[model samples]
Target chain A: MKFQQSQEMRNLIAAIFVGIFSYFIIKALTDFDIVPGVSYIYNLRGPLIAPNMITVILFDWRGYDTLGEAFILITAVLTTGILFGRGVLGGDVSEKDSTPIRPSTIVQKVFAAPLVFIIVAFGVVITLGGHITPGGGFQGGSVIATAFFLSVVVYGFKKNVFNLSHNSLETLEGVGALIYLCLGLVGLGLSGYYLYNVGADLYPYLGVGDTATRLFSYPDSTNAGIIPYLNIGIALKVLSGFCTIITVLWGAEKK
Target chain B: MNGSEVQFWSFVTAALLMIIGIYAIIFMDNIIKKIIGVMLIGDGVNLVLITEGFKPGGIVPIISEKLYNQSPGIFQEFADQASYSLPFALVLTNIVIGASTLAVLLGITIKLYQHYNSLSVHEIFKEEKI
Candidate 1:
């Protein structure tokens, strides 16, 4: 058909155009410095501010952006639930996903339990060590959620190691979001800023007492005050949010 | 390869990925392949941002107390030698956003399949009523 031919021609043209444009753009990007950027400034101040540069930018400088990022995951999970007949405008709530999950082999069954524990432990270390090391809450939480995935894949969702109820996962997500909001509110109450790192090392300048600082601060040499807390909060939210999504997609039982 | 060379190759690979993804999205009839195209585009852009963060002979942008205990005055040196952190942060945020969007897209695809009983784009379009 003529229409089909035109569609194919258009697609080819678009692909060629995109390829050429990207090549030029990359050439320009590499050849030109494009003025200066804040990366160097972040590097200079990052050591004194926080040991991990990305953590400082995400938690301290771009806290609002991080909040939006977490909210996106939550929104996606809710949308998935809606698609599965858990919300308004749904006729019947009896549909199940046809993903064809096969029965697990004996070897997989034997190894899955300990593997879940080890994965969860590694995720915790990543979440708690965000201030001084790489792999923050988002990465850590995703890692932890994989353990849930593994368990479900190997043992089926009914008897999986992390067969938490829908209500519990939703509650955990809310708790995580609240932790993040309350921490920002704490900063707002003390200083005029929302996510200001008002822990001991810097709070003295704000004329706050040492006891309050110690209370706000975690035991990190980077003076990374609320970053670790934020990490834990984001990790919890991301973990629960991702798990909720997978559970819904894998087909939840009718309530 | 040097940093610039590495960046060039990375950009080439990213562009190829994006091109293939766009091709899939436009020309492929299967809905699942289209979804994968969306993912491929996101991955290409993420790669570009990551390549932009690369520095020639750069060090990791981390400062630890253990490293400090050995030499308390390595901050300046570390800053000079470290790769760009801003783009790294941006890439991290983008990855999460991309994953969330992918989840939403797949959900929509599932709903569509349930309603239409077919994964072929042309078949669904032909079957659509006014």
Candidate 2:
């Protein structure tokens, strides 16, 4: 009885707080032009270096923050592994209670192989074309992970076509992160600043000769130094990271 | 509605979603429900950030020949007409971070469920000493 009463009180307090917060939020959002008036200066500069503005910001201007974000994902995945990993506390605590269900024959026959191939190809296009288009490493990585997810769902985890073991995924993730770090160090070695793109001469051949009338029309000898490499690194890291997380979670429950 | 008004409406909708999420967190007894509430809140914040980047009459912040032809100095006039891209970038980062965090949380929740054999927060608290 006492607990119930306290719970009600807590609920009331929470409601009051939310109400106050909502009022203030609405007032501030409606009244004040809180939107920053800054023009797309970084974005305008993006084409000079890389084709994508978001990529430039993420991998060049704010490379350190992205590194941190990647690590945060790595740490979170590790924590999840530690918490629920097999053999952590003798064996897997959660076990499969029922037999796995097979999908309809027609559904499986129609859409399994072709869909996976298409999705993977699309993901690759997005990742590689990060410099030229709207999609980037993160988006492409997620799409690839989605393809993996579909395959795992259609064919049982044990019988999936993309038969990448957890160890391989882990290695891929680590290598991706290492490559990113090495690229940053390369920038530091060549230029004084870490992750610096200026004068690194990443795509020397492409930037030579015409130097201006490229298909993308990069500005004034500014090459997309190390940005595409960084995008590839991020794509690998995110793809493997997500794949590992899902695989671990799904396989946690063994028969 | 005007551009600002549209933004205001979007902001209002985002806030309402957040409020609904808060209500779920406070009132729902299911641990999974709480996690869902947290997701809703994150979506609300992402919506607000994306909305903030919207310009009254701006196109996608892409540099093309059309923009350059209009003004050779693409940095000055072309940028003024394009919507801000910074918020979109920030939101993309936030979304990935949120997904990872949510995955971790869900994993923990699964462990808790395995131990307690129940999804109710109250039951788990009552059963466990801690």
Candidate 3:
């Protein structure tokens, strides 16, 4: 009756408003050229000495923003832990009334091993090759987290093959953040700028030659410096942070 | 259609997605549905930001030896043709922030459900009053 009519009226009004709004938005977007005439990426890329412009921008040009983003994730994770109570922080020690679900088939079980291996290997490649390729720490970290998530889903949380405890995950996350902070401090000590890539001088030889060559090489100002280390730190932090969130949420029992 | 025209259509689609997400947030009764709408809005905004950096004729922002070996003057040409990289960087940051926020919100929603025994906002509010 009245409720149904009011809902219909609301829908109509919403439709009209959206239509008008979208039209104006599209018109403005079409008319304006937001793309720059010349991107500063090329000029910055040579000095930063990173093959990937996006990485240089993310880990070098705007490193502080990323540091803040990591803290945001940490705060959110902490909030979730607090809201869920002690079970998550302490691990799933409580007695479960219902049995955990496991993959029931032999075929599913046999293939799971290879799949996990491949996924983890691929994540490593992406994270390590981030400077030379499109993939970066964030993408690689998510992929790694997905691998853990898949294992938990198929094998059940109780019998997860990774055997990652809550404390271990927390420690890994903290260590990652500390490493990032230390790298930034090192840069500040050397170059008088926070998060500067002073270690980038070692990059060119590492890029061109073998591992043996890199060990014998000296640092040059023309290399990518601390960017790779930053990427690794970010990857570790992101992967562990995500894994912690999932593990906490999954372990919490519904009352 | 021309390149700019195609970009314009993309913009239109992104705007529509954002509008639909807003609509869901405003009208949906389910708490989970509102969260889905929030995620949709985030995706729409990310798309808009990424697309805003599109050049009419641009290559990927990566620099190769081939491009560098061409000539010293070629770098300037390459820079002119490359798509803006800043927006891509910004979007990456936005995505991580969005994921964490969504996780927090979902955790809160689960807590609320545990207490109220209902996912409906109206139902929860009614229960609170009594």
| Top-DockQ structure, candidate number | 2
Model 1 per-residue lDDT tens digits across residues A92-111: 47465554468888999999
Cα lDDT of model 3 by residue, A38-97, tens digit: 246443344336667787778877889989888888888777777766446556344342
**Which 10 consecutive residues of model 1 chain A have the lowest summed lDDT?**
A27-36
lDDT per residue for candidate 2 within B53-100, as digits (tens), equals 888887777666655556543466656667787887788888988898
Taking the tens digit of each residue's C-alpha lDDT, what string does model 3 give over B6-95?
A: 788888778777877887787788899888889888988898888877767877777666666554433665576567887888888889
Per lDDT, the best of the predicted structures is 1
Clashing pairs in 2: none
Give the range where candidate 2 chain B is weakest over 10 consecutive residues by summed lDDT.
B65-74
Clashing pairs in 1: none
Local error of candidate 2 at B104, Å? Answer: 0.5
For model 2, chain A alone compared with the true chain A gives a TM-score of 0.80
Instruction: Give the lowest summed-lDDT range of ten residues in model 3 chain A.
Output: A212-221
* Rank ordering of all candidates by DockQ, starting from the highest: 2, 1, 3
